[model samples]
Target: MAQAGFEDLVETFEFLDDWEERYRHVIELGKALPDMPEALKVPATKVEGCASQVWLHMTIEKGTLTFIGDSDAIIVRGLIAVLITLYSGLAIEEIGKVDVAGELARLGLNEHLSSQRSNGLRAMVARVVQTAAAAA
Candidate 1:
């Protein structure tokens, strides 16, 4: 029910009338993420569906799962930050329980992104969900 990541992203994007500013804002958010662990930098965690190279790391703390990741592309890094914000700090069941595709639809970002990118983003989230489920 809390609008932490996706909602915030939509609100912010809407507030920015210019795509240039929105892009900058996203990059800033990506820059704000905590450093990715060295161990997580391995090729195994690299996301394959991205047009750019992306690395994701997952951690389980208490009952919640958190994610940290990086992308070689700036905008993609920001996008990854957006994904991390929404997907992180959620338990596997909670994540799987939520209508993720619906959330993205509610935010109306799916149409803004290319079909390939949209599918890739979904794939990344799916991998995160699978990883979390496996851990659970």
Candidate 2:
């Protein structure tokens, strides 16, 4: 399965005429996400405040941060994929300054998300940003 990048998602979203089609695309993105090892889904890496069980793992190598995440809810998983695309492989300085909520807004996802899902997404971004801040 081919993984879609952030720009790819934006283009696809723009191509879709309605929110339903965009939602299906998001689910497809979740389906294409690489599976996370069960061992990596421990409490230590779990994201708090999400309605679903979400785990985020961060690794730093040579000053670049990489993020991998999984969620029990399919939509949340798709949201995680978006977050990964935005944040992963970024330099510590870049990660520290990135406007994650703004990115979600630019994707038009923020307006479409339910309050619970939006809060969960915020939690996920917060965890990653915190990790980046500590690394920086």
Candidate 3:
């Protein structure tokens, strides 16, 4: 559920012609995000530079990486939900192997967001990548 799943998501977005529909689709996808347990949401894991209070954490076991994240804002939580779909279920090294910018373009998110939203998305990706790197 890495590369192929990512590609499928891109295809799914392309099937939508309206931005509002796309947003709804994205939010629906967000609902599929694995539940983030309350115990993992702490200050140190909290990501700054976001419009909302977001907490992100990682734990690697048997060489596979797992993410735990949450946000105080609904939209940002949905955004992080997108992040989890892209990066979770991968090994730490594999997470580092991704070209996030390219993937964003492939997913059509790069062309479809406000400048600030795009920047916030990149920040989220950076945090996920940094977490993977540390685990590696």
Candidate 4:
């Protein structure tokens, strides 16, 4: 099951008819995300494989996982916001159960994103899942 925040996003996407509108919405979402503290952007949190510089600082408390992320590219930052909605507040055990690809397809992201962005998204998901597995 997707998180409530993600479900809300899906609803909004459904209301928007054009890809351009959806794209703009995604950028706005990114703009809405709070800045990730510079101190947390260290190599330890840096995600490899993204064309854009990206970092995700994760924390788990009482078995729930959450993260703050940033990306050098604006659209990538929006993608990070999407990922946060998809995965944050989930229990560590639940992370592996999520169908990341299937969920993304619902928003038509798979077809729209460039190969590089798709690969980067996959890498980010991998990082989150790996961290959750280790925590679990």
Candidate 5:
């Protein structure tokens, strides 16, 4: 099931008239993310395979998973926020059950993102899944 925040995002996307408005909204979402501490942007947290510099830090407590991520590019940061909203607060085992692709498609992201961005998003999802599996 989609998280409440993700569902709200989907609703907002539906309300937007065009991709341009959606894209701008995405940038605005990126702006809403709190700045990651410089110390947390270490090599271990850094995500590879992205066109822009990206990092994700994950934590699992009491069987629940949550993450914080950041990206140098504005649009990419928004994408990270989307991922955070989708995957954070899920149970460690439940992470594997979530259909990342299908859920993202609900927002028309699969059709709208550039090829490079799509690949990067996949890489980010892979990292999250790997982390969750290890924790579980």
Candidate 6:
């Protein structure tokens, strides 16, 4: 099964009519994310290239990858949720092959994102892909 919030997230985004609503939805997703343990937010998991402080923790079990992440910025946290939606719960090979940029583009999020946020999002995706590749 997909992660708890994954399918609903995509459906909600598709249902929203405009960027503003989508942005609100994304923020809401961030707000709804379960809090990561403070101990897990160490520098070893810190994501580079993000203007906001962000950390990613990935676990692989029976060939499926799972992720938990956090960010100081609300929108960045939402981007993390988006990354989780795009990449988590797949086999490592599937994660390495996912076209995250294309998916973001298809959602019309890439164009609307500020350059820094876009870079941050890319950084998070890169971390997930690289981690998946390691597991593979």
The lDDT leader among the candidates is 4
What lDDT tens digits, residue by residue, belong to model 4 across residues 1-136? 6678999998988899988998998899899989999999999999999999999999999999999899999999999999999999999999999999999888889999999999999999999999999999
Candidate 6 structure lDDT: 0.83
Tens digits of per-residue lDDT, candidate 2, 1-136, equal 1123666777778899988888887888788889889999999999999999999999999988897889888988888888888878888778867766676776789899999998998898889889988988
Per-residue lDDT tens digits for candidate 3, residues 14-119, read: 8888778878877776666566788777777878777667788877788777676777666567677777767878888898788887877766677777786776
* Count of clashes, each model: 0, 0, 0, 0, 0, 0
In the order shown, the candidates' Cα RMSDs to the true structure are: 2.4, 3.3, 2.1, 0.6, 0.8, 2.2
- Per-candidate Cα lDDT values, in order, are 0.75, 0.83, 0.74, 0.94, 0.91, 0.83
Better of 4 and 6 by TM-score: 4
Of candidates 6 and 4, the better by lDDT: 4
Model 3's lDDT to the true fold? 0.74
lDDT agreement of model 4 with the native = 0.94
lDDT of 6 by residue, 5-39 (tens): 56666677789899999998789879977888999
What overall lDDT, based on C-alpha atoms, would model 1 receive against the true structure?
0.75
Question: Between candidates 3 and 5, which one is better according to TM-score?
Answer: 5
In terms of TM-score, the best-performing candidate is: 4
Worst 10 residues of 5 by lDDT: 1-10
TM-score, one value per model: 0.80, 0.93, 0.84, 0.98, 0.97, 0.92
Candidate closer to the true structure by lDDT (higher is better), 1 or 2: 2
User: How far in Å is the alpha carbon of 89 misplaced in model 5?
Assistant: 0.4
lDDT of 1 by residue, 22-134 (tens): 65887798788666777888988988887877888877888688878887777677778877777787766687776767776654556677776776787788888788788
Q: Rank the candidates by TM-score, best first.
A: 4, 5, 2, 6, 3, 1
